[model samples]
Target: MMTGGLSETKSATPEIQDMVDEVKPQFEKKSNEKYDTFEAIEYKTQVVAGIIYYVKVHLGGDQYVHLKILKPLPHTGEPVELLDYQTGKTKDDEVTYF
Candidate 1:
């Protein structure tokens, strides 16, 4: 019934920013650990039929993540490896965390 009330006036930007800031360090540390633990991984992907692409994540240690890479409709470019850490699995289409 009430539109743009006091509740709506209170912004979530700062709360989100603070939350991100608080967790950023922890996330960074964990990400660094993942990077350090897996250094011999490789990734491959190719765009097909517009925005969908076949993605292969080879985590080298012994695990992999395979998924259909897609962005929101009406974007551009195939799925590119923004951040890839591959482990060069012997078999194909399997992802494991080591």
Candidate 2:
């Protein structure tokens, strides 16, 4: 993949699901909405100083949210952080850099 460019979007995997779980609380807090169902639908990744993940998540039916999460380089011992997010998204919305 090209440096600093987002990778092609891929369907969510188990690893990606775990990452979503890790940051779900932060997302709920930021959005001020508790989701009864949170599932990762797809995602794209950009290589930076660390890694930026742009994920499309399903919040039950007809509801979705896009999350921007940062995973610091392992050597730095930094926690994965929920950087920002966009609410009121839909299944057709493409997950892109924000």
- Highest TM-score: give the candidate number: 2
Q: What lDDT is reached at residue 55 by model 2?
A: 97
Q: Weakest 10 consecutive residues, lDDT, candidate 1?
A: 1-10
Model 2 — which ten-residue stretch has the worst lDDT? 27-36
Each model's lDDT: 0.32, 0.95
Q: How far is candidate 1 from the true structure (C-alpha RMSD, Å)?
A: 17.6
The residue-by-residue lDDT of candidate 2 on 1-98, one tens digit each, is: 99899999999999999999999999989888899899999999999989999999999989999999999999999999999999889999999989
lDDT of candidate model 2 versus the reference: 0.95
Per-residue lDDT of 1-98 in model 1, one digit per residue for the tens?
12211111112244333333343334336446342222212222233333222233333456543323333234555332222223233544343221
